[model samples]
Target: MKLIDLNPQGGIGANSIYLQIGDVNILIDSGLNPKQAGRLAMPDFSLIKDISLDLIIITHCHLDHIGSLPVIMRQHPNAKVVMTHSSKMILDRMLHNSANVMLRQKEENNIPDYPLFTHEEVDRCVPRFTGMEFLQPQKFKGKTDEVEIMMHHAGHVAGACAVELHHKDRHIFVTGDVLFENQRTLRGAQFPSGHFDTVIMETTRGTTERQVGKERVNEVSRLIASINDTINRGGSFLLPVFALGRMQEILSIIHDARKFGRLVKCPIYAAGMGMALADYFDEISRKYQHVQFNRNIIKELNIQPTARKLDAGKDLKQNALYIISSGMLVERTPSYTLASGLIGSDKNTIGFVGYCDPDTPGGQLLQAKQGEDFTFATANVTTKLQARVERFELSGHADREELAEFAIQTQARSVVLTHGDQAARDWFTKELESKMPGSKIIDPVPLKTYEL
Candidate 1:
């Protein structure tokens, strides 16, 4: 098999992969980088512009996985696009939201290349999407070769999946953004057992060691306790989360805490595409057995919309719980602006629940010490970091040990790592080399082709 990493900037950004087996050419995903703006945020489609793609497989609906779908679909009009049934239901919504964000960025950030694809372009790509049931084998023929494709349930978000490809007798698996542990509203990943010829996996949490006594259940309790402590002290608590999966999952967890009287009574403020996605999650849960979210949770929690314009360095003093988006606290986002105002106060709390890229504001804050000077550059606010900054092990990715064990158990002759920073990939490379002496471990460079 021949492969190329199409993400121009690499390091978990613009996550597109090109694979060629026999006469078949496949594209795994077309994602945009949240850190970069305009055309630079998208995958380098120019690498495969001349090649006729046979199939496009969408692993999930996260912006980092399917953000550039419309761009790729426009170039490969003849290629077939496939995703899990649940992903198919939410793909359009995610893309439309992305387009809207790009349009706003174009004006706000002064990027002329913003709005890479229009809403109409997204609509045109929708008719081509073919949703498939998990583990159901579907065959696609090339000029002289064919491959059977199947998707397995990968517990990261509502409709995430890991791709399995069978070309002739050689088996290949691609682990998209995956989470093996169960979350409040989603079950753990249900991957197949056994061996394969080649394995491509995500190494997201490679640098994060598995700590003892910090499992999901315990972490949930700690989070609730922290929120209660902050609320009772008459201070607000902020949860910076991704709008797609994290928002819904965190809200569900909080609802359970309140239902059992384990949480304190305080005003809950949440608004964004995530709130709108609750309706879709409710629909998905009712129609499918895999998901477990209900839109009624919003009503039960008495959620309120966040104030339209949040001023920097000015706290509202509501003593409320704020759950907002741009999980990594990207510049100019709701979380970034609100955090600027709340971080100077010693009474407030800011807790993170998912992976944060080292280059993002959230990661910088995590590395900062209490009473240190922190700067919110975009908001023009600089102050002493007095607020409580905590991180829960409630990430949406599997632990490094579990993922490495899975790859080692597969015993694939060639193991390739994707979707991680350089440090993360390095850790996985060292771990795999020491344990699996006979296997070939690869970390492909961006836009570089490798034959395995």
Candidate 2:
């Protein structure tokens, strides 16, 4: 058996990996960086194109894992696509939305350097999906023989999973963004306590020491209290968050605090898809009761949108607490426009909820270098917002200790780390090697192959 890292070497972007066993090829993920389309750079598929691809398993709906799947399927039309039911549903929505965004950008800019696939391609790929339930083992027809596969809950998102493959006398495990402990929306990753021949793990947060659970919650509470204090002094709070996991978690926290009278009853505005995602959480509360604090509160919380539009009228800006999306302050989002309007004022506070790419405007704001003025863009109007900026340690990824403990407990013969920067992967490999002797740790460069 051999493992190949096809793209996204060094964990910056565009992640793809291939597992080859003789003539049988199993493609785990086929993601591409967004900037590649403009550069017209295509992934090299010469290694797997000659061999018959038996299966294409997707771990989750994140673009970095499943983004290039439509194009890949077009190249290899016979390969069977497999993922969880919920993952398929979310993937469909995400791909369609992404395609639409690309098309819109192409038209708006009149540029020919956008994405290659169309909405029609996304539509065709949807029917080829085969949904697999968690923990159920299935056999697929390989080029030479049958390969047994198992899907386990990864706890990253709704219906995310880790893949386990068994063939001949060897077993391999692939962890796709696992959460070690229970979070607001999903259960922690669960693997059968046993030894394996090889294990492939993601180390997105491997280099950093995660804040303790209690400390995380306390930090969020304190930030909220600070916002509330500003509001009591006749100010408003602005939080730009991702519309997915982080948004739902923060909403639940605020709702719980408000229910117990820990927070004031000011109007909380949820802009963009956050309102819809919160509703989805409420609708699917039963399925995720294991991770929720109070399912009843989730059901009863009124998550109505306070600001219907993004005009940024003075009255609207002065009254409600706003939670908006495009957490990075990217274009075509309400958060960017709002930030541009509120940055010069001392009556508003901007709270960053999750990780921000350093190149993004939100990231620049968080860095807050010495003697630099924060700027935001709003529909051709540039504004400077001078509100307080703060960060809360509410990441969904597992901490360093949790990841080390998980690796030690698995006791695999060999470990391969991915989905992190080179520094993070190296740190994890060194620490795990020192703590757990006799286990081999390897960090393969992008497109490199390792034989086992």
Top TM-score: which candidate number?
A: 1
Per residue, candidate 1 scores C-alpha lDDT tens digits across 1-452 of: 99999999878989999999889999999999998888899999998999999999999999988999998999999999999999999999999999999999899889999899999999889999999999898999888999999999999998899999999889999999999888878888999989989999999998999889899999999999999999999899999999889999999999999999999999999967888898888898988888899988899999999999999888889999999997899998899999999988989999999999988999999999999999999888998999999999999999999999999999999999999998999999999999889999999989999999
Q: Candidate 1 local accuracy as lDDT?
A: 0.93
Q: Can you give the TM-score per candidate against the true fold?
A: 0.99, 0.88
Find the candidate with the highest lDDT and give its number.
Answer: 1
Whole-model lDDT, model 2: 0.72
Error of 2 at 141 (Å): 2.1
- lDDT agreement with native, every candidate: 0.93, 0.72
* Residue-level lDDT tens digits of model 2 in 165-277: 88888888888877766666667777666778888888877667765564666776787797788688677788888766667777777776787888876766777665665
